[model samples]
Target chain A: MSLFIVNILDGLVTGLLLFMLCSGLTLIFSMMGVLNFAHASFYMLGAYFGYQISTYVGFWPGLILAPIIVGFIGAAVERYGLRRVHKFGHVPELIFTFGLALLIEEVVQYFWGKSQMAFEAPGVLKFAAFSIAGNAFPAYKVFMIFIAMGVFLVLLYILTKTRIGMIIQAALSYPETVQNLGHNVPMIFMGVFGVGTAMAAIAGVIAGPVLGTFPGMAVLLGSIVFVTIVIGGLGSLWGALVASLLIGWLQTFAAAYNLRMADLLVAIGLTEPVDVAQSMLSDLWTLTLPQVGPILPYLLMIIVLVIRPNGLLGKRET
Target chain B: MNRFTKSLLGAAFAGAAMVGSFSIAHAEGTIKIAFIDPLSGPFASTGNQGLSHYKFAAEELVNSKGGVLDGQKFEIVAFDNKISAKESLIQLKVAIDQGIRFIAQGNSSGVANAITDAVKKHNRRNPDQQVIFLNYSAVDPALTNDKCNFWHFRFDANADIKMDALTDVMAANEDIKKVYLIGQDYSFGKAVAAAAVKFLKAKRPDVEIVGNELHPIGKVKDFTPYARKIIASGADAMITGNWGSDMVGLGKAVIEAGFDNPIYTYYAASDGITKTFGEAGEGKLKLVMEGQLNPPVSDRAAAYTAKFEKQYPDYDIGQPRIANVIEMLAKAINKAGTATDMAKVAYALEGMEHDSIWGTKVVMRASDHQAIQDVHILAHTAKDVTFDFDNSGYGLRAESTVKMASADSATTCKMKRP
Candidate 1:
């Protein structure tokens, strides 16, 4: 029972962290027709920037300043870079961001070199917040969960209850009509992109110490963030939340248990092969739940895509 | 069409061709060793550091001693394999096409396995274009045991040998009642887990292996859950063979989870990890390596480290075997009386013995071509340390040392000699 409760808490922390990246991503995809392929790179930039800032002035200042710096960079990228390539259509826009992602990784390597940085958590949050069944839970992880939840709440309020949110929602569906109504549609798109990237940066700043601040951090989490939003519904914020939690729980539970496929096969009345190496199903027999934990999210995504087509909350055809 | 103009153009073209041919001939006189490793990926720092050391060793140690085999200078040509086995093979072909006969790589054992097989097949198929592989740091035991090749020579002790020394230290510690084993889910990791189990059972039969887990190599974004599992296992000591960012993440998670027991690792030092661990791992993290750095093994070792640091301030000599590799190669080439005769040089390198910079005698065993040298188990400590690594303000203090002879045993290598 204690293990189950701990797994739930662990899943919540992971799920919320994914939501932080997916929330901004889903918003940008909703607002702008172009999917920002460089979104995760922005997260990497955030971690690097936060690490650099923390070196100069403790972790708190880095937390406040790094995301803001990343926000401006993201805004400039959208305004000057993405805006220039927008007229060339979605393919070119995607290609441009894809190129941007590679460029960002190179720039990061050029500056920081290709190794893990010494980005550690502050002294106050370095200890365990509590222990469950002799297993200590880190204070920083609890802090990450709270911050992610806080961001979700604030984003929810701003997207639904505010005038700018309503304008942004209108612009997503009919940009021409919104522009004709005297709203700055392009400016709204840029703002959404900036804020979305900032959210990713915020995730990076906190996650850097825990996840490891390195050049590959973006690549590690990049595709998974896309999977989270896709399984939720590409443009639906609530859908992203649900999918993120689902994946978080799925992976956590899977990794926490050690179930062998061979045991399941035996239980189902299949005879064990004499020469396992020569058997065609040898790999299947040796497979364990933890070994396939990381791919569970992708498998879930495929199943959801095939059956639902529109995702759990996704409204579009894709 | 003018006779004077045509004659002048022909003269100029003749001069350009002469210069190109001369340069190509000049390059062929030098012993070119292609250093194929990742130079532009997440592991680039390690590869670049190695390249820097190889260049320095070739120039300072080999060439400065009036070159090898009577002025046939050593040259290290860098090739970026991006830490991929397939990419490494492509780079190998490129290196061969460029007339590089000797290849050196030490990053991934997977890449090492690929290059060894490729070199074996290449030598068999194209006898005229044979190449020797000098391995400095890949420590997978199978390279010398089951997959040993005549052309491949390892300058570092393999995993099984390192585990033997590690278990010796573990067996002496009566406080270590329960142990946890965690490693990356790959060949090297599996080897580590297996060796740990084998050696621990033989050495300390009463010790309990509370947990044994293998996490995805570099895909893990969080290690908190894994750390929690380890903590719950009531293990007093943890053993892991994870390196690079994986090591950093696991160490950070272990420290953050407040698991205060000592963690024994193969690569917890060097790179930026020592700096990252800093005070967090003081006395809690221990590493098993080839040489002693904090308390210099000898004055010459200290001076070499100091001079190398002064020359290349950004890098540290993480793999001390680099110097040994170069020195041994030079000795073999000189002994053969020619750099071009790789067959003779290979014969010379077999059963070679030399005094290393680390103040230990290293032997390249004829049976498996695996280097036998003293290995040290060091503990991470911040205070009363003689020297610090990577400017991390922390250093590893020598806890125990394993002799070379005791570390050696008969291998399963059926080497096909020329």
Candidate 2:
């Protein structure tokens, strides 16, 4: 059915957006040991920056400038702030990033105020790319899908093929060897941190128009980003891609249907409660697939965590 | 008056100001309405917007006109509830502790319900210090129906009341064959959904109810999937009661996904939503509310909006009822002959009719303490519009109006007067 195809396309868009955030996150985790809890905050910064820039020039200038600005801020945070707190161990780094997230959110609210910004996509991408059974699929969503894929390909090429990328990879496992070879590992880490945050910022720029650009935008995607990376495997880029798309589809399919648990109970010969609304098990009986769609990713993450401690493609334990 | 003087004169000025306030209050007295709502967090914009409206109305209408009950100033003291029921109760206690007899809140119905119960209990336990809840925008019908309170008064039309107005507009449109219902998964959303179903069935029984869905509030980022479901359902039209980012997001998703039918909504034209709906909505998006801004129902309404905008450029008069609330509160205080006697003031507010500046007659229904007024189904488009929202060149134009006479329906509120 056209509905199924529409769901697929929608799921792909959602998956790609998730992958955009997850890719940066997993890359940073692989490069630097600290999982930046302020990752989503960086994304929010990107969206606000994009909106500000777009208002001045256009959406194009905003797309290019916002992510780069956010990148510089990220790099500076790694060098000046995160680096200082790194020696205190993972808990402190976690706490530091957590605090940084809260701080960034407040700073954003202070500057932009607590409301949705009118950040829109370019006029060219405003039209529908195609229509499915009377429903028009936005050109911007298709553009987002391509951007994520392009980022993946470019990141894949650089990480495996480039000299700087090779050195960065070398420093990841054997820092002393890489350092003896005249490569600055700490600077590389900072660069990777910056680059990772820039990727998140890029996602923000792209997703801002569609997902909405508000103070709570970061918080909305915050936990879900963690879920994506964790379910994919800690530091596996491919794993993140797989997990992100999987979640995108999971949520999409979940929301697309009206599958209820009560139906299964009825099919199994269980009698329906006379007063379902008044019963103690009302929530259980009335529970629908779409109602719990948002929680699906978390549920999947828990299952993955319990069953496969490493994740789908993770070589090491999470 | 010169800068950088803090030792003697500045201290004396501070002392004088404190004594001045004390003398002012002691002389003519002050009616303090504790504003307990989300003053912080994501949804703080809605609460802050309401607070701004109340303050501006109090200053411009009541205070500027020589105050109420012979120079008794209306002071709005804010207490952040964080939009939580528990926090609202705590804030209610704090407001009550401050000797504030009047409580004004209208953000979340859950919070309103909690405050209503707490105020009811507070009045029962301590009848001498009775508190009156001046609700401005919580639209759950239960607050005026099943859970109707003697101490509480709702200025905004409840969900069922608004639905009554909305269904009137929907029934007139012959093209609307199917309607898809979507809402945020909460008490208010549930109330709107239930009322919409009930009203539509009663008014137009032939209209097929297609997809009815409730997603977790503020959780879903992309409504494309939901949009797809709506489109696939073959629904010609859609109705939703979603607000805030949810309203903007849902509205944008459905509109962008090519659901070209009319999308009826509540609270879709405020807090940057109007700007987002610009160019995209084109004429599809419509909402049911107390007043239409673009057409400027009257010169007074237009002036009030202009002055309010000059004062707070970042905010909008989303809740037009705030004007009615402050003016009526001042009138009730004067009519009751005392600001401290909340019961007497409540009696005054009950059965009171006021010709609003927006060219509508608002009647505070005595049975349920619910304000019945002329409700407008306004379009968020530029057709026959002047005042644009968020300066987006797209504003509300009245599509239809449900007068106060027809807006009033049978109430199930059992009057339990103190």
State every prediction's TM-score relative to the real structure.
Answer: 0.90, 0.93
CA-based DockQ, model 2: 0.53
lDDT of 1 by residue, B296-317 (tens): 8888788878888888766788
lDDT of 2 at A6: 88
Q: Which window of ten consecutive residues has the lowest lDDT sum in model 2 chain A? A: A107-116
| Candidates 1 onward: DockQ, in order | 0.42, 0.53
- Residue B379 accuracy (lDDT) in model 2: 87
| Model 1 residue pairs with clashes | none
Candidate 1 local Cα displacement, residue B35, angstroms: 2.6
Residue A30, model 1: Cα distance from true site in angstroms: 1.8
Pairs that collide in candidate 2 are none
